[model samples]
Target: MSPQPQAAVGAPLSRVDGRLKVTGKADYTADHDVRGAVHAVVVGSRVALGRITALDIRAALAQPGVLRVISHLDAPRLAYRDNPGAFMDPPVGERLRVFQDDRVRFCGQPVAVVVARTLEAARHAAHLVRVSYRAERPSTDLTAPDLPVNDPLPPQDYERGTPKEALAAAEVRLEAVYRLARVHHNAMEPHATIARWDGDRLIVWDKTQWVQGTQNELAAVFGIPPDSVRVISPFVGGAFGNAARVWPHSTIAALAARVTGLPVKLVLTREQLYHGVGYRPAYTYTLRLGSDRRGRLAGMVHGIRAETSAYEHFLEGTVTPGRMLYATPHVGQTYRTVPLDVNTPTYMRGPGYATAAFAVESALDELAHELGIDPIEMRLRNETAQDPSNGLPFSTRRLRECLRVGAGAFHWDRRAPAPRATRDGDWLIGTGVAVGCYDTLRLGAQARVRLDADGTALVESASSDMGPGTYTSMTQLAADALGLNMRKVTFRLGDSLMPGSPPHAGSLTMASVGSAVQDGCDRLRRQAIGLAVGDEGSPLYGAEDDDVVVLGGRLRVRGNPARTETYERLLARNHRTHLEVLGSFTPPSEPERSSMYAFGATFAEVAVDARLGMVRVRRMLGVYDAGRIISPKLAESQALGAMVGGIGQALLEHTVTDHRDGRIVNANLTDYLVPVNADVPDLRAIYLDGGADLDAAPIGVKGLGEVVAVGVAPAVANAVFHATGRRVRDLPITVEALL
Candidate 1:
C-alpha cells in the first residue's frame, strides 16, 4: 500500500482523550462503581525469613462491620498446579502459598486478609489480626557473600582475537565498577483490584498492563477454565512496569471475595508497594575496555551481578548491547543473578539497558578522557554500522547524526575539558553526553475497525493506554487510515472482551497494535471502496479498483477529485448500513537481516554545590532516531517523562529495607523521594527526520518508550564527575558520597 499523506502520523496532534482526562470523565480501575463492593485489607508477615508459628483472628472477627478473616488456615484449597508458562516466572519451590502455610521468604508477605463493609474497618481489623514467626537473618545486600549465583546462559564469550593479548597490545586500557541502587516503579496510581465471583464465573477490575495475563493467572489459581474469567481494565494511570504481572495482593483479593461471598476491592498501600511488586534489582557491574591511543576500541569484557528473589530466578537483558554496540574483536561477558531474601524483581522502564548503558557508556567516557579525545569523535571512530553480534546491517541508524545534532544543540565545542574548570559562584557547572540504544520489538496484535454509514468509525483493541496516550495515538492512526476526521473516530481499549492483543510493553504498542489497527482500517476502507465500485448506479461504478481511493470521508479516484462522492451519500444511494473489518498484524516470520534498534544521544548539564554537596540538573536534551513517529506531541511527552523518571532513578529513588527485620524503612512516598517540578528544569527532545525500513512493520515504527531513558543516568553521572572531580559509581550519588 502506498503511504498516505502525513495527516495524523507525523503531525503534532494533541491527545484525543485529553478532554475526557482533564475533565475527570475517564474511568480508572479504582473509579469503577461496583455496587455492594466490600473492602479487603491484607495482613502481612513481620519477618523476612521465618515460619509462621501462630495466627490469631479472634479480635479481628469480633470487630464491628468485619465480615471475615481469611488466611491459609481458613481459605479454600486450590489445585496448586505448577505451570511455568502461566507466569513470567513460575511459582517454584515452596511458593509462599498465601495463608496456607506460613513460611515467609520475604517481609510483607500476605499472612491473612480482612474483609469488611468499609475500607477503614478492614484496615483496622487487619491491624488487629496478629501473627508470630520464628525469624532468621535475611540477606538484603546485593553484594553479600552468601548470595546464590545462577548461570542463566553459558559463558557468552566472543573472540576474533584474544582480548587479553589485545589488552596487552593496546596502549591504553580503562576498567571500572559501576553500582546501581534498587529502584521502584513509583507510578502515580497504586495497584488495585476489585474481584467478584458470580456462580463459577470470575470478574475482576484490575490495574494491570496485561489483562489476559491476569485472567490466565486467576484461572490457574482457581483451577477454572480461562474463558470463565474476565479481566477489565479500561484505564491505567501509569504502570512503568509494576503492573506487568499479577502480584500476591490480587490473588488475596480474589480469595477474599470467594471466601466471604461478596465483591472485594483491594488497594495496596504505599508501604506494601515496596515488597508487593517487582523493582529494578540492584546491580554491580565491572567493565574493562581496551583501546588504542587513537581511540579505536580493541576489546571489551563485562561482569554483572543482579539481585533476584530466593524462590525464583529473575534475569534481564544485561549482555544484549555488549555484543552489538561497538566492533570489538575480543568481547566476553559474565552475567550472574544473585539470589537474595526479597521478592522477585522484574523489568523497570529500560530494564537491563539502563543499567548496562551506565557501565558501558561511563567506561567509554573514561576511555575518551584517557586518550585525551573528544567523546563524540571517539564514538564515531568506533561506531559499527552493522550488528557485530550477527553481522547484519542496521535497518536505519542515524546515531552519528544524533551525536552531531546533540553536540551542536548542547554547545559541546564550548565545554571545558578539565574538571572543576567551569564554576558559577559556589557551584561547579559541567556538561556530559552519552549514547542510548534499545531494540525494536514487535508482537502479534489484533484490532477491529468499523465504519458506519453515518460517517463515524469505531476501533477496538485489547491493548492498554497506561498514560502513554495509546488510545489517542491509535485513534489518530485509525482516523487517518480510514479517511475519517479525528472527531468522527472512537478508539476503545483495556478490556479483554475486545480482540486479543499483546501487552503494552517493550515499546512495541505502536509497531504491533498500531499496525493491527492500520490493517483493520485498510480492510474496512477497501470494503467501502468495493461497495462503491461494485454498484452499477454509483458514480465510481466501472472504475478500476486500483484507481479508487478513500480520503476526507469521500470515495474518489486517485488523482481526480471531481469524480468524488461523500461516504454518507454513497451509502445512502447503495442502501448500505455499515462496513466492518477485523484485522491483525503478526510479525513476519523472517525479518530482514538488519540491526533493528532505536538510538538516541542524551546531553546533560549539571550544577553541583561545592559546599553542601548538592547536585541539580540545569538542562537536558535528547536527540532520537526512533523510526517514524505517529504522534509528535505524545512522543515528546514520552521522551520528557522518561527523562524525568531517569532523574528520579539517578538521584532520589531508593527502596531502603531494614535487614534486621526485613522491613522496608523508607517505603512511604514521604521518605522515598521523586523528582518534583522544582528539581527538573529545561528538558527538551529532538527526533530526527526519517523512517526505518517500511517492510519492518506496517507503520514502520521502532519502539521509543524505553530508549529515551536508557542513557540519561550516565549523562548526569558523567556531568557530576566532571563538575566536582568525584567519581561516584553508586546510584543516587548521595550527598554523603560527595562529601
Candidate 2:
C-alpha cells in the first residue's frame, strides 16, 4: 500500500478539549448528574492502631433528611472476591475492607458512613455520629531502627560481580544517605464516585486513569461478572497515578447505593484526600560508591528502605538505576519495606526512578567535586553502551546526547567548578545538571474506528486523559493515517465499552493505544482504496493499489492528481453508508533483545541568600531524547508541568505525619506547600530529533511524561550544594537544614 500523506501527526496542535475545559463544560466525575442520587460522607477514626470500643448513630439518624447510617455493626457483608488481575495491586496482602471490622489499622480509616438527601445533610450527620477508640502509639517512622519490616522481593534486590571486594580495593570511595519525604497528589478535582444499580448490573461514574481496570475491579469487589459493571470516566481533572487503583470509597459508594436502593454520590473532602488516596512513599537511601582517581566508577552498593502499610507490601523500580544507569563492573543492592500504621502508597508520577535519581545523581556530583572534574564530564565518562544488568543493546540510549544538548542550551561552560565561587551581592548563584531515565513500557491494546459516508470518522479506545492530551494526540494519528483533515475526525475515550486499553500511567498510552488507533485507521483507509480501484464506474479503475494514495478523503493515482474521486462519491455509488475496523497492538513477548528507555538531562540554577538561608531557583531547562513526539505542543506542556513538580519535590512539598497517632499533620493544601507562581521561575524543554524506536511499538515513540520528572529534584539539590558549598542529603533543602 502507498504511504499515507504526513500532515497532522507532527503538527503543533492545541488540545481538542481545551475549550470545554476552560469553559467548565467538561463533566468530571462529580459533575455527572444522576437521578435520585443521595450523598454520603465517611466518618473516620480518631486514633491509629486501635479498636472501636463503642459506637452510636442515634443522633445522626435523628437528623432530618438523613437516610441511613452504616457501620460494622449493621453493614452487609460484601463478596470481596479475589481480583488477581487488578492493575498495580499489591501481590502480598488483601485490600482494606470498609466497615467490615472494628480494628483500625491507621488514623482516618473510615469506620462509618452517613447517607442523606443532600450533601449538606450528609456533612451535618457525619459529624453527629459518635465513636470511641482504644488508641496505641503507631510506628510511622521510616528511620526507626527497631521498626518491623518485610524482606525485599527478589526483583527489588540484585547483585552483579563482586561489589564488596571491588569497593574495598578502589582508590577513591564516598558514602552518603538521602531521605525523601512522602508527597501527595493534590489534583484540582477531588476523587469522586457515583454508583447506580439497575437490577444486578452496576454503572459507575468515577475519577480514574483506566476505565476497564476500574470496571474489572468493581466486578471482582461485588463478586459479579465483569460485564455487569460499566465504568465511565470521560474526563479526569488530574491524577498522577493516584486514581489508578480502585479505592475503598468507590466500593463504599456502590454498597450504599445497593443498601439504600438509591444512587449514591461520594466526594472525598479536601482533608480526607490525604488519607483517602495513595502517595509517593518516603524513602531512606544509603549509597556507597567507589571510583578511579579520574572519576570513572568501579563499583557501587545501595541500601534502600521505604514505608508501606502493614496490610500490604509496595515496591517500585527504585533499585534498577543503580544496576543499569552506569557502566559499572560490580553492583549490589538491598531493599526493604518498613511496615507503618498508614495507608498503602501508590505510584506518583516518576515513582521509583525519581527517588533513585535523586540519590545516584547527587552522589555522582559529590564524587565529581571531590576529584576536581566537571559534573557533566563525570556522567559522560560512566555512560553505558549496553544494559549493565542484562547485557542487551539499547533500542535508543541518548543520555550522552541529552547531556551535550542540554549543556549547549543551558550554557554550562559558564559554570564554575568550585562551590561558593560565583556570587552577586548577597546571593550565591550556581548551576547544576543531572540525567533522568524511565523505562519504555508497552502493553497490549485495541482501538475501534468507523468512517462514515458523510466524510467524517470516529475513533475510540478505553484510554484516558489525566493531563496529557490523549484525545488530541489520538485524533492526530487517526487523521494522518486515514488521510482525513483534523476537523473531520473525532476521538473518544474513557469508557469501558469502547475497547481494551492499558493503564494510562507509565507514559505508555501513546505507544500502546495510539499505535492501535493508527493501525485501525490504516486498515480502514486501505479498505477504501481497494473498494475505489475495483469499481468499474470509479475514476482510474485500473490503477494499481500500490500506486494509489488518499488525501483529504480523496483517492487518486500517485502521479495523476486530476484522476481522483472523493470518499463521499465512492461510498454513495457503492451504496455503503460506513466502514468500520478494529486495530490491535501487542508487544513482543520473546526474551529481551534490547534495552528500551526514555532519557533526559535536567539543568537548574539556584540562588541562595547568604544571610537568610533561603534558596530560590532562577531558571531550569530539560532536554529529552523521547523519540518521535506525536504532538509537540502537548509534549512541551508535559515537560514543563513535570519541571514544576520537580521544583516542588526539591524545595517545598512534604507530607508531615504525626507519628504519635499516625495522622497527617499537613493534610490541607495550605500546609502542604507546592510551587506557586512566585516559586516557579523560567522553565524550558527541548526534544531531540530522533528516529522512532520500532522495537517499542508501531508508533515508534518513546514515553515522555515520567522521565521529564526523574532528574529534577537531584538537579536542584546539586545546585543548592554548589551555591552554599554544603551538601544536604535530605529532600526539600529547608532553611533550617541550610542554617
- All candidates: TM-score: 0.97, 0.99
For each candidate in the order shown, give its overall lDDT on alpha carbons. 0.85, 0.92
Winning model by TM-score: 2
Candidate 2 structure quality by residue, lDDT tens digits, 1-739: 8888889988899999999999999999999999999999999888879899899899999999999999998899888888876775454677899988889998888999999999999999999999988888888889877887785445467899999998999899999999999989999999999999999999999999989888988898888999999999999999999998888899999999999999999999999999888999999999999999998999999999999988878888898888899999999999988888998899999989999999999999999999999999999999999999999998999889999989999999998888999998999998899999999998889999999999899999999999899999999999999889999999999999989999999999999998899899989988998998899989959889888888898888999988899989989999999999999988888976899999999999999999888999999999998889999999999999999999999999999988888989899989999989988899999999865888887889999989999999999999999999999899888999988
Model 1 worst lDDT window (10 residues): 87-96
- Flag regions of model 1 displaced more than 4 Å: 1-3, 80-96, 151-161
**In the order shown, what is each candidate's alpha-carbon RMSD?**
1.8, 1.0
State the lDDT of candidate 1 residue by residue for 165-228, as single tens digits. 7877778888889989899988888889999999999999999987887888788878898789
Model 2 CA RMSD to the hidden true structure, in angstroms: 1.0
Show the lowest summed lDDT stretch of 10 residues, model 2: 148-157
- In candidate 2, which residue ranges exceed 4 Å CA deviation? 89-91, 151-155
Shift of residue 435 alpha carbon in model 2, Å: 0.3
